[model samples]
Target: MNTQEHAVGQVHRDDISSRMGMWLFLFTELMLFGGMFFLYSVYRFTNAEAFHIAAKELNTLIGCFNTAILLTSSLTMALSITALQKDKKKLSIFFQLLTIILAFGFLVNKYFEWATKFDHGIYPGSDTLLAMESGEILFFGLYYVMTGLHGLHVVIGAALIAVMTRLTAKGIINKDSFVKLESAGLYWHLVDIIWIFLFPLFYLIA
Candidate 1:
């Protein structure tokens, strides 16, 4: 076999390894959130009525709206990846920018949602929340912890995408070497998936 062919084969193997490494890291993230979801399940099972009442206080319309925004962002991320694969750099950057904008929108919605909760004194350590039933307190506590963590992820994802956009503009992440964009998309999809689980558990508690 020629030396050049062997070099290409090695590069292909390296790409596979890189992707495998990312999947492993993502698995760890899944387990981290998985444990939180388990705790939420146990508490909800034990305190059904309080959870129900507390969930009713949540703004379902806003929750659904944020879900739509995240889902659309996920689509944009996918399109960005596709554009990169097709060597459409400008289109890729456009979609990446769109995804970042949607991420900001999602955060804005979350801020207002949390603000409304705070106005009602429903925060983690607020006296009002403390006075609520054990089940309701548990619900809000987990709600804040879980969703807050997810929001942090969204922010980080947006930052990563912004960097990817810059790299694409600089020709550092072009079609020949676009694994970074793919990895960012995977992370963004994870963010959206977590919210999908969260939305129903927190807002559809009928």
Candidate 2:
């Protein structure tokens, strides 16, 4: 409850328990994404045309760029945790900052891409929604729902990183640091992994 009273794998925000809890939470997130993927399969089977058309509308190059960016950030995050474990505070903070910057870039690029789509009359609902036939409309419907949820996770992951940055800067995390940096890493990896697949599905399903 105090961010340090973890037990049985609740992720006391630090320690083995925290890592276990992080894995547990990640498993649940996996299941959630799994269900979405299932939905995607169903709809793609039903609306192959719309799905293909919508997929083409996405900017594949940009998606690939972001994928690389996230993968790099994941590397930095892992290095940060390793540095923390080795009692390398300064290096840990440096990697953490790098990871943060990369994450921000990923989100900014996403914002611009999505904004451009909206400008071109494509969004969850409204004119674009009206323009789409039933199956096409349904295609964008799933697109919005899935990507919107993933975006929410991005925001949440950024918030977590901000918190970790603060805690690390304040010297709250140590070799024995009771911070959930690893769990943070776990969540970060999950975010990256989700995007990896989503990029292909949403942008390059040819």
Candidate 3:
């Protein structure tokens, strides 16, 4: 057999391992967040009124947009991996760039929402919070915590994609492309699923 055939076989094996790892990692993440959800439910039950009011205050439209952005990004990421498997490096780069752009868009929308709220004294520990009714403040506090963590994950995922993009551009990663992209997709999908729940909790609870 020629070198190309050997390379192809190795690449195929790498793809399988990459996919399996992604599934395992996703399962562990689900369990981790499942515990958090359990605690959140306990708080939600005790403060239903406040949680509902807080949900009403958020913009559901924005949440919907972000959800779409994340879902689209994941699709693009998957396409990029497919392109690489076919040895279409340029197309792979294009989709990866598209994914980054979508992630950035989500962050931009979040920035505007967070800044506006901050300007209006709506964040946790603000004077409004200190003097406001009890349950609402707690709801906002949890809101800030969970979304903030999710946003940080977005940043991390984007950074990882950036590294993958560079690696591909310089020809350092070819058949191994699935390894990096799969890990990213796993994390991205997790973030996307979290937002699915968050949107309804923050904007459509009533």
Best model number under lDDT: 1
RMSD of each: 3.1, 4.5, 4.8
Instruction: Give candidate 2's whole-model lDDT.
Output: 0.84
What's the residue-level lDDT of 72 in candidate 3? 92
Measured with C-alpha atoms, the lDDT of residue 50 in candidate 1 is: 92
TM-score of 1: 0.94
lDDT of 1 by residue, 1-206 (tens): 23333355434535665777888988999999999999999999999999999999999999999999999999999999999999999999999999999999999999999999999999988999999999999999999999999999999999999999999999999999888889889999999999999999999985
Error of 3 at 18 (Å): 4.6
Tens-digit lDDT string for candidate 2 (122-168) = 88767866877776777777777888888889878878987997898
Global fold similarity of model 2 (TM-score): 0.88
Q: Distance from true position, residue 137, model 3, in Å?
A: 1.3
Off by over 4 Å in 3: 1-19
Model 2, 50: alpha-carbon shift in Å?
Answer: 1.9
lDDT of all predictions, in order shown? 0.94, 0.84, 0.81
Better of 1 and 3 by lDDT: 1
Task: Please give, for residues 43-104, the per-residue lDDT of candidate 3 as tens digits.
Answer: 89999887887777788788888888988998898898889989899999999999999999
Q: What is the TM-score of each candidate against the true structure?
A: 0.94, 0.88, 0.85
Q: What is the TM-score ranking, best to worst?
A: 1, 2, 3
